[model samples]
Target: MANFHVYAAGTGSDVQHPTIRRIGVSDVLDALRLGFEDFWDKPSHYVFLGLIYPIVGVVLITWTSGGNALQLIYPLMTGFALLGPIAAIGLYEISRRRELNLDTSWWHALEVRNSPAMPAIVVVGIMLMALFVVWIVTAHTLYARVYDDAVPLSIGAFVSDVLTTQRGWTLIILGNLIGLLFALIALSTTVVAFPLLLDRDIGAYAAIETSARAIMANPVPMLFWGLIVAVALLIGSLPLLVGLAIVLPVLGHATWHLYRKVIEPAPAPVPVKAARSRKRSN
Candidate 1:
């Protein structure tokens, strides 16, 4: 069974906050470079996970197009940012293993299930999922308020309305402004939390606090990092979202490197008997 004790204080070890580092734009760039290297080293390892996004993208687009919920399609695509951290957990594991020179085969990505922090990871993932749901509901409400229960009849009509009308401009401006808030929240909280949890046994609370502290300590660099992520994802989303096949894994691996940059390495464990022997000799 997965260990749930990571959430309980002093369950196995004392819960202490990990040290947060103040990284700069250089560090962020280095992380991305290293991430790309990781992806290049074994592109085949990430193929399955990468293809999943395109498939899901196609399905969601079809669902919205068929159901006359065109307003929701954009929201759904943007909402992927909020859930991206959770989806990339497996990528983090693969990167972690490679960092240690361990086996990083495709199946090894699933090895995270045996991690001590799995339960904590699950909790944080659920939090992100809940946030996604809220964004969708809020988007729906925004559309309803502006359009008043009138669903766009077709893709061409929806595009024309969204592009040519005053209400369309209002929807565009307000939706983007609101979407920025949600994206910021996701970035602030999860920028390093998932990878940190996978790397160490820190509880979810400590992981989140440390991630927030990392951002607070280096807001400019972190914000720049967030911008890089948004732009990369946006580009990946073009061409039928197929580009994400390469973009997601690269970003995912890079995120692991980013966490390494932001968090200090865990301290080495002291030898218990050596302490007692030294005390007695003294």
Candidate 2:
């Protein structure tokens, strides 16, 4: 993350006031580098949990196979990445512990289970799940709407239709537009909220508000960061999702660093002389 002081202005007299900051593209890249460093430092902590992603991927692929099922397959597999932020709760903890020079073992990493933020995190998790559910429903509706007369039951038939037909082209354009809407909402609300929840005792709504403010303050860099996340997760899912063992942890850790960059820490109180003069100074 960039120097905290640059963005650490006090929003109010309250100590816990969230201070949003603007960041550049370089800070985003730096966050990733730090994320990789954290991952390598404690590779063992993530290995077992990372293994689970592949198993989940395999299960999802198998469950969504066949002809008509093809349409759902792409969204279901990629859209699950929408939940990657919440799922990486453990990773954020690991990164936090590492940054503080605290214990970063399996026990400390999963400490989110007992965190004060658990209740709020649960609410946020449900919100993310809702977004994912909506995407799935929308995708299914789009597929059915596109192929009104008949259904394609095989992969080849499905592929041929989408590639060679005007209806397929329309579905592609419209489905992606709808999918993009869901993705942007997911990205804006949770990009920094999960990490903020893990770090503070604040409620979910507060964390989400702070995350939104952070993005709005740095719209350009946040947009670039969002694209990086979407592309990385998509690529990671391509190779039977075996790449997620490395990809998910890295992104999770990087998100913590990025959050640090965008959400300024509360500034120290003004000196006695300045405090008196600023009472009505807005």
**Model-by-model lDDT, in order?**
0.88, 0.81
lDDT of 2 by residue, 1-282 (tens): 221111222232232448887799999999999999998997877866676676787788788784347778778886888888877899899888888888888767677898866777888899999999989998888888788736557878888889889998998889888888888899888889889888875667777778788878888898898899888888888888888888888898999999899887756768997987788585
Error of 1 at 104 (Å): 1.4
Clashes of 2: 2
* Model 1 lDDT per residue over 1-282, tens place: 335665633466556788888789999999999999999999987868888777887898899889889999999998976888887889999999899999989888888898888888888899899999999999999999999969788888988999999999999999999999999888888889899988887888777778888889999999999999999989999988988888899999999999999899999887999888989999
Best by TM-score: 1
Best by lDDT: 1
Off by over 4 Å in 1: 1-3, 6-9, 12-14, 278-282
